[model samples]
Target chain A: MIATRIIPRLDIKGPNLVKGIHLEGLRVLGKPEDFARYYYENGADELMFMDVVASLYERNSLQDIISRTAKELFIPLTVGGGIRNLDNIKSVLRAGADKVSINTAAIKNPDFIKKAASKFGSSTIVLAIEAIKQPDGKYFAYIDNGREYTGLEVVEWAKRGEELGAGEIVITSVDREGTGIGFDTELIKSVADAVSVPVIAHGGAGKLSDFEEVLKNDVSAVAISSILHYKAITQFQSQKDKLEEGNLEFLKSGKKYSKIEALTIQEIKTAIASKGILTRN
Target chain B: MTVNLKQVVIVDYELGNLFSVKHACNKVGLETILSFDKREIENASAIILPGVGAFGDAMDNLNKLDLAEPIKDFIATGKPFLGVCLGMQLLFEESEEFGAKKGLGIVPGVIKKFPKEFRNKKMRVPQIAWNQIEKPENVDWGTTALKGIKDKEFMYFIHSFYAQPIDRSDILTITNYNDFEYCSAIHNKNVSAMQFHPEKSGEIGLKIYDNFKNLIV
Candidate 1:
């Protein structure tokens, strides 16, 4: 049984995970490594460490924070921000990072995705598309934290991103981010329907039901940072046991081992061989 | 009844996606090694054969890397060999894509494409969407990953072709789109598989992987 994932995106400033409001005024929540492990331990499927300042920071912060997150954090970590050229990507990858995310730099030079794909392959490169839905219900691309408008249609840009070579697209509703209004499932369906690669639906996750609405589609993955950050929803609970008993397949498979009887990854195996889990469902 | 620790090595063929399975085992604190070495594969508690992408290329890569032999021998030992997607298809005798190429032949079937008629105009052939999962009534994953997601529940799927499994009992989970029920997972003593990318599926996905790792140990 393969699992769909829930990943937490941490915007890092230097060595710590920081959260900002509308791309301004920031506050330190916790260390990137600690928060990363916390999420992984708590039931986060994977992690995204956006070097929010990697592009803006005077120093790349490549070696220090990302390396720390990679070495200490464990679970797959995707690092992005200020990644302009291939050298930057190579530098971070060498530092134990699993994937590299690019935004402003990629928009400026579309060829970046192609080159990275050629080397690391499409699976390792995640293209972050920041979109703002206009008054007319059309989406226009926004860069630098929604300041500058690229005037590019969201769907067209997404297709080009896939053609240029990207493993996944994290299409975030800029207005919906951090609002807890629930994800824009319609927007996500359009983008996911338009491309073959994986799509990570971000922005506006108010509750588990919101997750249920988005999960209704076959997008690649879903990323919820604020909802998890604010403690709106708990990641993997005994829900699988309940789902299994409830006779629901989708709900049962994602039961994290962490939540199931405090077994290590290895013990989870032994537990299975012994038929410890009651087959009631 | 049970298996020992550190005896299994997940054969990393480097041709398809091994991250989800490998990462899941690692997360559950399982000490499984990821390798293409023959010695390691032959003497393991279990072997996870995971792959994605074109079948021809995958078989080509496995042959080029000289893994076909050891992989077959590994299955002969009957110590649990789990194939995912392309990896699962390789267990069959042959594949229909890019000409009739040979596969590992552990299972008795060939890989084929999906039928191109759908109730929804946009429901396309690749089966690329989250649909309901139909749990296998007979086979129970005792302490397994499928624990989280239940029947008629959804997981992510993205592929044009799929395996029409030779052994009906092997099919563990299926996803219903229109009139058809596509097999999403399979299990046959010492061998199991899932067409979906579980590692990428989030918490529920990890739970599934953790259960798979438990099977290995």
Candidate 2:
């Protein structure tokens, strides 16, 4: 039995760590590296850095951040957002990311996944699918942080991605993102069952039980953003003086999100592990 | 030849995570140079072969740079040598990734992929999760780079193909995944290799580099 992975997902806007509800109205947190270091020290299974606005801007700014963070933290880092070509993937890997997740480019050109997997090895590529429930009760794939819809069904797309050589898939529920309502287990289970590769569940997750609930869906890992970020902000207390970009007002005005309950990575892992789930200690 | 004794040469074949491996070595207070120069690798006190990519491509890059012979020669010197992830797989004789591909043949083994289906149940390839490293029978870790590390310590792994040493005595540590236990690390005299990326395994992983640094003298 493989140990369930607990990953802390950090959404970055420029240099500041940011979070948004349903992938909109972004609120700036403190330094991403600070939060990353904290999570690593506190027993995070892995760390994910997603540049939330990289696609709209058509450029990634997290290279420097990834480099700096990779030096101190010795954990697997998966980077996503605006990874368009082989060069982009190469640069990120050179910056010390173990894997590069692709959502937009892969949807635009499915063959890109095949080329990347063959060139960089399948395990180095991750297919990220943003899904939202439609009126027909079917999940449709969305891109650009849930701003654009692709019309393709989530489960079918995940299965195609695996056939195209994606070593893993990360499905983020646009409807549940940042809501803290709990994971879209239905969406996760559908994708997990459709593909043989490992699937990582992202978005939602308000409490510890939320993790246990999703793990039962057969997700290889759980990526939580607001839950861990909020807890970390209160615990670490961002130094407002060091921040340079994004909306710093949130940091200045007591970082708190009423929609989600703050929970540490260790707290979530211990809670889930007690319920007969295997996790890395 | 006068070896630096403090600096470790990291073979750069343009396929692996040279940056993180070099960074990890630096964190452990060891000087490192990312190079493919034959003379540099041959003269270095220790060598760390770190990679993450297709086994065939890795071998092609190494051979293209004329590094195949130099690496084998370095190991023959009996100085500390470490292989991580694909780098460890490259030490074997052949791999089944994308059809049978030849390896550096330093250790007697062949790389095999995890079964797509195990016991009528589908198994995920590229076991991209943290798994434990347990000691084999009669094998004491106190004398290897895993020294001071706890038994069954979790290390980060991301690979589809795993090494199966023809000589069982070369097996250093084993890890269980998909209802199958496979050799995850190997130690034979001078060569020590791990399928997991110790450079990305956190504090416990840094301890491996620290132990490797201690072996430099």
Candidate 3:
């Protein structure tokens, strides 16, 4: 049996790794390459880099970052944000990303998925769907980092994307993103049950149980952000106290955030494995 | 031969990301180059056919570049050669993906799509996930491209169709997705191809490339 993947998703703004509460109040965590190296060493199954400002800036500013990350980080890297066309896909691939995830462009030009899939193979193209629950207890797809609504239901859009040759669908919950709440199990289960391709449940992974909750569904993988980011900060904070007091000035000057003792990838995998689910040891 | 000058050529058929492949080779301390030039193809110490695109288009590119025959001829020389993902599928005789299309016929097999449903459960196609590879008993892969890797170790996979080698003896590994078992890696003479991407599969994945590096060395 295939083990479920535990992926660390990093949202990039400029060259810095940023995290936001509910995808807002963005705070720079650190350099992407540094964090990527940390995650790669710590047993992250894959890494996802999304340029949160790409669509707004209209340029993929993380190309160099990705290129650098790919050099040292040997795991699978999936890059998203502002991927507008085949050229954007080509450039990202050239940067050494294994897969390109598209959200807005996929909605604007449905044919873009087909074109990219036809050109780069469906496996290289991932359709990222940011879904929101409406008042009527339904899910609708949103794009542009959940700032715009597509008016298309999540299930229907996922089916369409798969039909258009998308190899996987990453269903992110707008309702739960960055909240550290938990995955929208109902939404993920429906989407996972709807598509014939693998569905990755992104957003709202606050604890090991959260991963287990979503993994119980048909999701092939889970994309996490805040929890892991917090964990890295916590780990770094422990080392800071061991350094000379004057050396702490460098850490303070770089970036500072309250740390949480979040679980490591191995711990999460162990937790899941304890539940009788197989995971890479 | 000078150190750090080994020529491991990645056959670029104008499909997929050769950068990661080259980076993996470089990480393993193997000098890598991406080219479709026939002379480079014939002269390389080893050849890697890495691809991610339609079968027809890949074959079309190889045919247009006049690399199809050279590839076979290069393989005929018995130097190490590897095919990845779509590159692996192209080694089979035919693929039913996007209609019936022919392959390079390097391996006696047919590429098949996973059934829509398996064992009363809805099976996901394209199987984009990390699955373990079960090694066959008869083959001694202790010194081959799969060296330093244990049986049933996980590898990242992203594909809808899998190759069905006609000779079971040629299969190097098998992976179970849903109720069915499919050939995950095939090894024949100087040629070996895998359905998964070693470049994208982390540490163990790097070991596979290192093993390949050892093979050519």
Candidate closest to the true structure, highest lDDT: 2
Taking every candidate in turn, the Cα RMSD to the unseen true structure, in Å, is: 11.0, 2.0, 3.4
lDDT, model 2: 0.90
Deviation of model 1 at B167, angstroms: 3.3
Under CAPRI classification, how is model 3 graded? medium
> What is the DockQ (computed on Cα atoms) for candidate 1?
0.06
| Tens digits of lDDT, candidate 3, B1-217 | 6556566999987887688889889998888888989999988899999988678888889999999999989999999998888889999999998799999998998998889888998888888788989988787778578977889988988888889999988899999998689899999998889999898889889998888887885
B79-144, model 1: which lDDT tens digit per residue?
767676677788878878768989988777677766655564333444434445677777665534
- The local lDDT score (0 to 100) that residue A271 gets in candidate 1 is 32
lDDT of 2 by residue, A1-281 (tens): 47899899999888889998999989888889889999999998889999999999986889999999999999999999999999999999989898999999999999999999999889989999999999999999998999898989999999999999999999999999999999999999999988989899998999887888888876799998999888888755738667777777877888478878888888888898899888887
What digit string (tens of lDDT, one per residue) describes model 3 on residues A1-281?
88888899999887667788667667766667767888888888899999988987886779999898898778889999999988898889888888999999999999999999888888889999998899999999988888888899889999999999899889999889888778899999999988888888987888777877887887888998888887676555544444332223435565533332366777888989999887878
Worst 10 residues of 3 chain A by lDDT: A241-250
| Sequence-dependent TM-score of model 2 | 0.97
Interface CA root-mean-square deviation for model 3: 1.2
Report the lDDT of model 3 for residue A47: 94
The 0-to-1 C-alpha lDDT of every candidate, in the order given, reads: 0.66, 0.90, 0.85
Ranking the candidates on TM-score from highest down gives 2, 3, 1
Model 3 residue A255 CA deviation in Å: 11
